[model samples]
Target: MLWFLTCVAALIGGYFLYGAFIEKVFGIKVDRQTPAHTKTDGVDYVPMSTPKVYLVQLLNIAGVGPIFGPIMGALYGPAAMLWIVLGCVFAGAVHDYFSGMLSVRNGGASVPSITGKYLGNGAKHFMNVFAIVLLLLVGVVFVSAPASMLTNLMNDQFNLGITMTAMVVIIFAYYIIATIVPVDKIIGRFYPLFGGLLIFMSVGLISAIAISSDHSVLGGYEPSQMFTNMNPNDLPLWPALFITIACGAISGFHATQSPLMARCMENEKNGRFVFYGAMIGEGIIALIWCAIALSFFDGMEALQAAVANGGPGNVVYSSAFGLLGTFGGIIAFLGVVILPITSGDTAFRSSRLILAEYFNMEQKTLRNRLLMALPLFVIGGILTQVDFGIIWRYFGFANQTTAVMMLWTATAYLVRHNKLHWITTVPAVFMTSVCITFILNNSQLGFGLPMTLSTITGVVSAVAIAALVIIKSRNSGEVDSEEESLQS
Candidate 1:
């Protein structure tokens, strides 16, 4: 109870502070001339009302990753949940808020373009490669986790391979829709419905779980007990906290969101509503999932057994509805479908943006870009058919690495612009150091020397890029002086 209270307080306090000081005081303006900026052709870059943009942001940000990441983190202990909730407000919200602002200021530039402009062309290319790899990894992990959950639900209810078939069908349908449909139409209608359903289901489940449980409704086992049974091989609390907070903290997906959603903002002031608002909403969802996991199961082993035998959806259903009777079961079933749909649509939009940028298509028509992105989708889907666990592990590392790179870029921007706001810098430094430590601590190559070497390389790269920017600024100033001398 104390832990949960602390987390809630932190989130509430941080949101106000960030909104007042960072977002409102230090205002960022949207650039209109950039290629990716909204030209309002009614297809790709259609203008939207603030309310509509807010709705879209909610749907795009609330994916299965936020739900399950907290659940996994809860397995570490109740304390883990506290860290996640706090981190979401302090670190995650700030990242999303500023990243979107930065992108908008530079005319809907993606992370790569922003890096290129502020950092350099090489850094831009590095960020692009990083973004693509991160996207692929994130897509695969998210797809597999939900697929596994859905499979468990289908098997339990229908006694067939419905889950596997559904996974394939959903992926196929997504690609087909992506190939055919326009971005604005797809997002404008589908996202709001998806987000609405998620809110309804989450509320329904939490209410049902609280009423049905025999023990104290909100109260659960202690944080210490939650950790005692966890797998020793699992990473420690700090690193695990970092991983769990990945999307909510600083997702690579924000790059996609920046360009896709920025055009709709009625004013630059609304960036706070779009970015910070979406992140807090995501954090609340994570908190609910953590509560459900802890309330339902006695320990990690029981939860694992439930998942292994039945699937994650089974665990969620059993935990949520098992005590509530028939109606509860039905609600759980519907929630299963809603969860994946929310995630699937977000993935579709993200992939579309990536393709749009790669091909440099006019924002007016995305048909060609959609066609080009189909092969990549199919390839990812095929890879999903093979070993998923290996893919998940790799994805975890890749996602964290991408976050590190983005944080480095954000840090550079702050340093160069002399905007070293503690809200951004402190979390950025902690995340970077924790990530580097985790990589080094886990590496098995040559008594950890190889991991240390890699960490040093990454650090050097970040510093070198920042140094070059400073030097370039100095040289440009010098050139202006020399030109003035000649003119005079």
Candidate 2:
């Protein structure tokens, strides 16, 4: 309990202190004309209130990653708390802040465009393809996940006799409409309500956790499980924990989502609140879920076994329904159903925007937006035919790989501007290593090497990448000095 409380407190403090410093480093100013104000296209580039943008951005980056990821992350023990707190403060929020602000500075561009600006056109094209693939996967994963839950919930509680296939078709229809429509029309006006539900669910779960404290709850770190890997699979924490707990910590996927908010923000000052603050908010939610999952089940062994037996979604349903009663049922429905739908819609939308931006295609007209979006959804619909579990296995690595690129791109941006570059550069190296090593260590994914060998190779690869950045920074030239013309 102390650990959980302290982690929460620390995350809050990180917002005002570390979070503010990041905003400062990015040189935010209230008077600058955001792309929303300068380039007002009702479809993709409409101005919105700061608070509203915060919620939309929050809902955009969050999904099952924060919830289920932390649940799985707990398999590595309470050390997941350490990663959530520290990683959220330093890596995740920082990554989000840069991605969002840089997008705003670069004409509200997507990750691939921004990467192209800093990394190069080749890297840009690569990222363009890479990002689209990840988003499609997100679209598919979010679609199947919520649909599966809805089918079960409807059958179990309401006895409505719904099937997973029917649910998928229904939800996929919503994703298509949400993708082609104007942001303010659908996502902007309603995401806050969904965001409110998400916050409410978090609070309810926390209260439930507090009430269940007297049961055979999980205790502090068994000294035996402390530093040596507590992962049930015996994978090292170096990459596995980092990759598993991507949302609360640092994620490349969030960079893709940032441009969505970047196009909607009315002021540069709101960047931290929308991007950095949202990631912190997600970390808290992840921490709460981790604490609950760790305690609600017996020990590590039993928690792992339960997760293996029932799956994360079923566990979420059973545990919440048991703990919070009817309220839990409602919350479970929202968690397992609605939130993922919201995320899927935006994932598809973001992909459309990225491709539209890549082609220098305009999104002012409905026809233009739909023209870009239709084929993507067609591909996504076909992707639904693949087993979702198989799609997710690759999605995780692709997500971290995207993060690695964005971080390096961010470092390059900082260096290009002659600002502090080490902030992103260090984490860039770390996450780069994690992604590379995870593939190398896992046999089906890459070379089936010994864990020790994989770790060394990953670290060496990370260092090489970081060293190249340092050398480039040393040799880099002048900063882009054109500041945004203030409209206010």
Candidate 3:
């Protein structure tokens, strides 16, 4: 309980302390016009209220990553807590804030476009393909995850008497429709309702924990029970824990989603509150799930056995069921079902915007929107039938890998402008190390090298990248100066 409270407090307080510091570093200017005001196409670029935009941003970034990821992360015991609280505050929030602010500065551009502008043309082309694929992957995964849960809950029949297959098709159609429609129409209005349920569910679980002795925090591990690598697969804690808890900490996916709100933000000053603030909010929710999964199941051994038996979704359902009775079960169903559906909606929406930008298609007309969207929905449906486990495994890799690219891009932007480049440089190196080591060491992903060998390779790669950042930092300022001279 002590550990949980302290971490929660730290993440919340960091929003004010560190969030403000990063805002100052980024230099928010109010007099400048935002893309929402400048490019009011009324299709993608639309000005939304600060509160509405913030909630949509929060829901867009979170999804099931915080819930399911932390349950799996808890197999490593309290070590996951350290990553959630600290990684979120220092690495994740910083990554999200700059990515969003940079997007706003660049005319509400998608992340890939922003990367290309700062990093180079080569990086831009890579981002074009990479961002689309990642967004589609996110969309498909969210659809299948929630569809399965809905099937189980409906017992193969719903209030509308539709089968699971029908449910999936209906849900997939919603994704397409949501993508084609205006942002203010679907995403802006209902995301707050979905977001409310998400937060309300977390709070209910927390209250249940406070009132029950059986759900004591840290009860699953004592001082000696802590930090000995509790994973049954013997996966090394270094990279696995970091990747396992990606969304709750820092995610490259957040950068992709940031542009959506970046297009709608009323003021540059709101970036910290919306982008950095949303990431911190996710960290708190993840900390709750991690602590609950750790302590709520009696001990680490019990939690592991349960997870192995039924999977992470089982843990979510069972926890909610145990805590709040019938209402808890309903909340659990929503957590597993509705929340991810909303996330899938935005994921596809991001894909539409990215593709339209990539191909230079105008989205002002419904005809253009449908022309692009039909193929995406078809591909998403085909993907749903493929092995989702395969998609999810690659997603974790693509996700962190995307973060590495964004961080490096941010690092370059800061250096060219002669700001604090270290803000992103340090975290970029760390995540680069994690992604490299995971591929080299994890049996499913990499060559299955020995841990020591993989660690050495990872460290070497990080150092090499650091050296490149320094070199780029030196050249960036000169390039900027020349460009300024030319413009002057």
> lDDT of each model, Cα atoms only?
0.61, 0.83, 0.84
| Candidate 2 per-residue lDDT over residues 1-488, each given as its tens digit | 66788889999999999998878776786887888988887888899999999999988888888877889888888888889999899889999999899888877888997887677788899999999999998899898888887887779888999988999999989998999988999999998888878877888777777767554234545645544567777766777788888877887889999989998999888888999999999899889878877878777787788788856786677667877787676774575466678889999999989888777788888888889899998999999999877887888888889989999988887887777888888889888888888999888777878878888999999999888876675576543443632111
Q: Model 1 over residues 1-488: C-alpha lDDT tens digits?
A: 45555665666676777665667544554433322233555655566777777777866656566665666666666665666666777777777777677766655656676666555678777877777766665566556766666676567666786757577567557645743465566777676766666776677766766566363333766556633535434655655566655554555565556556765665676777787877777776777677666667765676656656654455666765564465666565555455545545555556655556656655455557556567667766776776765765565566666555555555555555555545665665666665665566555311244545645754655455445545664443322221121101
Tens digits of per-residue lDDT for model 3 on 24-118?
88889887778899888888889999989988998888877888899999998787888898899889999999889888888787888878777
TM of each candidate vs. truth: 0.83, 0.95, 0.95
Name the regions of candidate 2 deviating beyond 4 angstroms: 213-228, 479-488
- Candidate closer to the true structure by TM-score (higher is better), 1 or 2: 2
Query: Candidate 1: where is the Cα deviation over 4 Å?
Result: 29-38, 158-163, 215-218, 222-235, 307-314, 323-326, 443-488
Q: Clashing pairs in model 2?
A: none
Ranked by TM-score, top first: 2, 3, 1
Of 2 and 3, the candidate ahead on lDDT is 3
After superposition on all CA atoms, what RMSD does each candidate show versus the true structure?
5.3, 2.4, 2.6
Which has the higher lDDT value, candidate number 1 or candidate number 2? Answer: 2
